[model samples]
Target: MTLLKLTGIVKTFPGVRALDGVDLEVEPGEVHCLLGQNGAGKSTLIKVLSGAHQPDEGTIEWAGSTVQFSKPTSALRAGLATIYQELDLVDDLTVAENVFLGHEPRQFGFSSRGITRRRTRELLARLGHAEIPAGREVGRLPAAGKQIVSMARALSHDARLIIMDEPSAVLAHDEVENLFRVIRDLTAAGVAVIYISHRLAEIREIGDRVTILKDGRTVAVNLPARTTPTDEVVRLMTGRSVEYVFPPRSAAAPEGTPLLRVSGLARAHEFSDVSFDVRAGEIVGLAGLVGAGRSEILETVYGARKAAAGTIEVDGKPLRRGSVKAAVAAGMGLAPEERKSQALLLGEPVYRNVSLASLHRFARLGFVQRGRERDAVGAVTRSLDLRPADPRRTMRTLSGGNQQKAVVARWLVGGSSEGGSLRLLLLDEPTRGVDIGARAELYALIRSLADQGVGVLLVSSEVPEVLGLADRVLVVREGRIVREAPASDLTEAQVLDLVMAGERAATAR
Candidate 1:
């Protein structure tokens, strides 16, 4: 039986018609993967279905009955729950507390500790997680650990349909495999799943059927995963031929001087004795699992995070750690992994966030000259193709893809070639959560930056992304650089092997 049916769904946000007469359906005991590009109304559809926002026009028939979900609790009461990309589990709470948070199993009109623990443990076991103690604080648990707890919480709600958005984005390769196993178990128990993710590989792995969304409408639905070509899904979501999106690799000068070099880089309990060099006009990628020190290594070089022992050399000049000002003085720009937290100022205006990193360049003596700043930000915004080119618009209002472009814009502005202002760019998970077309744009932007002789060290968890975009890829695990290979010939299996080989205790992928 069809677990959920959505018809003629429509939602509008200010100037954006987020969803325009959308349609979707999910069957019981099936994984229905939703595919779409950024700003294509995917989130809006999910929000409407989950009752975060009411649809302007639509109808939802859930479990054979038409119902209106005015709030999330109402949806949950109707046996539907959603897990967002940013898991809603409270970090300060215990696993059991989070699992049965709102409606804890109660006896005598009070909390039943024994029953909650037993129930939490049972849910964890059913989800293939027996290692996590129910009483342990969720703040202390790993990301994957917290995810399992979140899943258990959904089950605790007695939800018949579970919607997971980008469930595998933060999970390591092995953890992803674990998640797939759990998803199988859920479907086996007749739970209908709505899976939304950008990782096409994971969709192919576990999705039984797919629904493709383009712009604000469902373009196709109920396509069997095996029979449908992956490229067809790509085309449907992007509206760009796969050839145009990926394109041919751009040529770069491969024989330039080493722009940035590291020797014996060490960050206590994070990364140890890591070393690599990125040549001028080159894109060097760091590929590893989420906790394998990829971001730490980049942070160490950027002076955002402290390093116990290491040496960084830019343009062949040895440098010491500490002080982000010093790192910037030495010609380094770091775009951190958590773009929202570290880079973009959501509350501030677009021009402000774009010019934030190099505000001094637009300063005159003791005051900021807004004209000079506006000019700089404007140029970068136009060059990067940031929508509207409105310097006065708030960063928070822009879509995810445009927000990322603004972050990249920060690094592009200010810094003469002769000065030590913009020589090296360190981008951590540059394309994380961004769509395929945006990713292609970012890759092209990096290639353009490299062509301008800026060395780039891109840190990403998706090994395939590294292989597709980088000139050289470095694999790190357990704070150590285990292998370095050309991205062209490096395979995902080889990268996983290096990550697992370096981590003896890690589970197999």
Candidate 2:
């Protein structure tokens, strides 16, 4: 029997028809993969299924019976659960508390803490993460740990079907393998999974069937996940074949004095003795697993974190340590990995967020010029092909890819200043939750920036991203750069070996 079915689903917001006549079917004990480009209605359809949004027109059948879930709690009560990309765990609460928050076991009208802790531990063990402490606060745990807690919470409810949105975006390779193992166990126990991700390779490995959505409608359904050709899949989602996504590297090698230089950079426990230089018109990439100090290095260089001992120089001039103002004054801009939290203003207008870095340019004495700010923001955003193309729209209304574009746009706006142009651009995980199509666009954009003589430094968990997009590849292992070579000289397998076992190999050599 079909575990869940949807026919002719339609959902609309004020000016957008998010979902239009979408259809889906899922069976028991199978991983149903959802594939689409960003803004292709995948999010809206999931919202409808999870009861966050009501479908304007559709028939949803749960276990062969028509049902309506007016709210998230209603859906959860009916054995449906959703684990979003942005985790919704409370920071101050313990793991046990977050797992059983709303539906705690009670004895004599009091919640049973003992039972909750025991259950949480059991769930953690089942998910192959026995090291995660049930008593530890959720916020203190790493991203992978928080993901496990969310899954434990879903399992606690005895959910028959679960939806995971980009669950592996934050996980390392070993963690992703552990997740697949847990999914196998769930499917063995007859739990259906609706897996959403932009990684086609993952779908081939874990999914049983596939569904493709385009422009708020289903383009293809019931395709074998393991056998679908890459070109066919890309065409269905993007209306064009994009096999060679990465832009070509520049023929002229970077030479002359370095644009940005770091020597003996160290942060107590995160990283140490990191020394590197990026020359004008160069793209340098740092590749490693999560928590490998790649992001910490970028933050330290950009003055977001204080360096215990080191010197940073832009154009041969020393930068003030631990001062964001000095870094900005030196024409350095960092698009952090966690853009929503560390970079963007979600509640403000798109124009405001774009102009945040260069607000002083639009200010005169005691007053400000709003028109010039909007116009400048508009020009940059339009050049980036920002969707909707409206500066007045709220930043939160745009898709993940669009939000990333806005973050990059802010730096471009600052570059227009008279004496302070962007010298070096630092990007950490530039395509974290973005779709494949958007990833291609960003790759081209980064290359274009470098072509314009702007030095670029990038950090990515994806080895291929570093190898394909960067001119130089720096392999980081255990908070140190274990290997440095031209990107053309490194292979994916070699980079992985360097990241996982580079220190041992280096010692032996």
Candidate 3:
């Protein structure tokens, strides 16, 4: 059956047409993938379907009948559920309470807590996660655990169609495999799924059909997900023949002292005995599975987390442990993994966020020189090609890719003319939730920064990204460096094998 159909979906916002005549269709028991770059209208179309926003012009057919959803509740009641990239669960709520939040069972005018917990447990078991305690607070669970809870909540509605936006972004390899298993089970039961992700390989693995959107309009509809060439899909989404290619490494030898040196770094239970050095104009990458301490290592080096032992030296000067201020003072800039929470001030203006790291330069007598600050930020942001190109716009209004650019631009503003204020840049999963097109731009930008003689230390879950972008590759597993080699000496398969071998060995022990 044609479970859901959207035709000519036109949605507009103030000074922007978010979706311009978009179309989509989902069938029972099929995984329909929606592919688009950021700002390509995927989010707007999904919001329209979920009733978060009403389309200015469009036709929606649900179960062969024309229908309109005015609110999220109405859409939920109509058997449509959406799981946003940022989860909606309340941190303080229990798993059971979150699962049955809006529609808890009532007994004699009282909310039945027992019934909610029992039902939530059952749902979790059905979704292949019987271990998550129903009474535990949602905030206490890890990212993968939270995702499973979100899935249970979606199933709580008896939803016939579920929309998952970037569901695997926070999940590791094994967790993603588990998610795929759950998705397969959902589709086997005749439920429809509309999946969204930036990882093209995933679309081939789990998707049945694909619909490509570009610039607020549907470019191609109902293309075979697995058989469609990846390059063709990239062209459709980006309007250009773009390959996932990394820039050539600079042949010029790095001059001057090592920019960053970590001597026997240890973080108690996180990572231990980790040591590495990055030279000026060099890019060093850490490749490992999620939870293998890649992010932890970066955080420890950045002084966000105190190292139990060992020292971090920048330009031959040791940094004070656990002091972000000290790290910043030593010319270190970290674009953390969680950009929204750790790096960006969402409610602040673009120029303010971009100028955050360099505020001292713009300050005089406890007053900021706004004009100079704006001009400096504007120059860097323009070079990054940040969208909207307006310094006064709120950071929350920008897309994921643009927000990331702003974070990088923050370090670029008002730095030394010789090497900028940043001598070392630490990037943790820099392309986590960004689209392919934007990823290309970021890759180029990172190379340009390295070319300017800034040493970069990167951590990425994707092995190919690490190998392609880094001059030297460090393979970390189970909180230890398993192998170290030049990026040219390793392939993706070799890195994956090393990582998996560690996993198997750990399991045996």
lDDT score, candidate 3, position 15 = 97
> Where does model 1 exceed 4 Å of error?
243-253, 364-372, 415-420, 489-497, 501-509
State the C-alpha lDDT per candidate.
0.84, 0.91, 0.90
What ordering of candidates by TM-score runs from best to worst?
A: 2, 3, 1
Instruction: For candidate 2, write residues 1-509 as lDDT tens digits.
Output: 99999999999899899899999999999999999988999989888988999999989999999998999998999999999988999999999999999999888999999989999999888777888999999999988889889999998888899999999988888888888999999999899999999878899999999999998999999999999998899999887786448999999899999999999999999998999999999999999998889999999998899999989999999999998888888888889999998888999999999998888889999677999999999999999998879999999888888999999888898663344888889999999888878888899999999999999999999888899999998888778888889999999988888777744647622
Q: In model 3, which residue pairs have backbone atoms overlapping below 3 Å?
A: 415-421, 416-420, 416-421
Give lDDT tens digits, candidate 3, residues 152-177: 99999999999999999888899999
Q: Is candidate 1 or candidate 2 better by lDDT?
A: 2
lDDT tens string, model 1, 80-194?
9999888888888899999999898989999999999999999999998888999999999988998899899999988899999989878888888999899999999999999
Estimated TM-score for each candidate: 0.92, 0.97, 0.96
Output candidate 2 Cα RMSD: 1.7
- Local error of candidate 2 at residue 206 (angstroms): 1.2
